[model samples]
Target: MTEEIIIAGFGGQGVLSMGKILAYSGVMQNKEVSWMPSYGPEMRGGTANVTVILSDERISSPILNSFDTAIILNQQSLDKFEKAVKPGGLLIYDPNGITKLPSRKDINIYSIAAADEAGKLGLSKIFNMIVLGGFLKLKPLVQPEFIHKGLEKSLPARHHKLIPDNEKAIEIGKGLIQAVQVLN
Candidate 1:
């Protein structure tokens, strides 16, 4: 099974971290993985994105024009990668700052109000974990234990104490995601 995903959003939104966690979890699951991140020099509020590829067999390259899934966290990303998802693939996004919704019937679309929820719940730091949780609920790509280990592996030791909170965010995210009507 090969899953090519692009997670895109503004910088400081943990887009890269989410991709890294997925990459690490795929490694723990003994899957071939590749992670590539891109962002403007003026990070923070600038746009940021990461591409993560997981597969059972050897991956040919990290570059990709299309993806099996696209995790969009902002309006800009939605505008950019909405067409990048392969037909019958998945497109998950947070509808906070999005002025326009996705209008594709060929792919399955899901929305998770992660950013708003995180702000309300005071889980802003783990917002990406919540998003990750939503994706896992829909895809179940990697094992749970591997995700825990991935959290431990990706997050620095000093931040390890917050794992439980992150886990909780994930659980919340799982329940928050909802299917949107596929449009033309």
Candidate 2:
């Protein structure tokens, strides 16, 4: 199986980190994986994105013009990558700061209130984890054990104390994701 995913958001929103963790999870599962991230020099508030590929066979390249899934965290990203999802693919977004919703009829669309939920949970740093959870709900590509290990591997040892909170955030995200639109 090959899954090509694009995650886009502001730099400080953990967009690249989420992709990294997912790539690590794929590695732990013995799948061939590639992760490529892009961002502007502004860093914090500037747009950031990552492209990740997981497959059972060798990957040809990291560059991609389309994706199987697009996880968008802001309105800008939604506007940018909404049409980039392959037909019949998945488009998941957090509706925060989004003035317009997706309008594609060919792809499946879902929404996750990760930012708001993270605020309510008092663990705002794990916002991306919540988003990751929502993605896992739609696509169970990686095993849970590997995900746990991914967290351990991607996160620093000093901040490992928050793994449980991140895990909880993921659970919250899974429960919060709602289907906005699904192709028949």
Candidate 3:
């Protein structure tokens, strides 16, 4: 199976890190993977996005014009990548920053209230992992064990103590995602 994914959000929101973790998880599962990140000039608060490709076979290239899944964290990303999702694909977004809801019938749409849920859990850093969990719940592209391993691999040793909290955030996200009505 091949999954091309785009994850987008404002910088400091862990957009790139989410993609990295996903890619790392794919690698841990013995899948071919690629990760590419883009961001605006201002590092902290600027727009940021990443493209990740995972496949059972060899990947041709990292560049892509469309994706099988789009994980949008903010309004800007929702606007930018909404149409980039392939027909019958998946579009997952966090409702916190979206001003305009997605209107597409050809693809599956889901909303994960990551920000609100993270706030409720008192976790400011594991927000992305929560969203990742929601996505996994919908897609199940990679195993949960791989995700845990990916967290261990992606995080620095000093931050390893927070793995349990991150795991909890992922579970929270899995429960929070809800399917939205598809527009015709």
lDDT tens readout by residue for model 1, 1-184: 9999999999989999999999999999999999988855945678899999999999987989999999999898999999999999999999999999999999999999999999999999999999999999999999889999999999999999998998899899999999999654
Candidates by TM-score, descending order: 1, 3, 2
Q: What is the C-alpha RMSD of each candidate to the true structure, in Å?
A: 1.2, 1.9, 1.3
Question: Per-residue alpha-carbon lDDT of model 2 for 66-180, expressed as tens digits?
Answer: 9999999988899999999999999999999998889999899999999998898788988999999999988999988998899999999998998888788888888999999
The lDDT-based order of candidates, best leading, equals 1, 2, 3
Q: Per-residue lDDT for 80-174 in model 3, tens only?
A: 99999999999999999678999989999999989988888789788999999999899898898998899899999999999899888888888
TM-score of structure candidate 2: 0.95
- Candidate 2 has its poorest 10 consecutive residues by lDDT at 37-46
Give the runs in model 1 whose Cα sits over 4 Å from its true position.
39-44
Q: What is the lDDT of candidate 3?
A: 0.91
Model 3 stretches with alpha carbons more than 4 Å out: 39-44
Specify the highest-lDDT model's number.
1
Best by TM-score: 1
Instruction: Give the Cα RMSD of candidate 1.
Output: 1.2
Q: Give the per-residue Cα lDDT of candidate 1 at 2.
A: 95
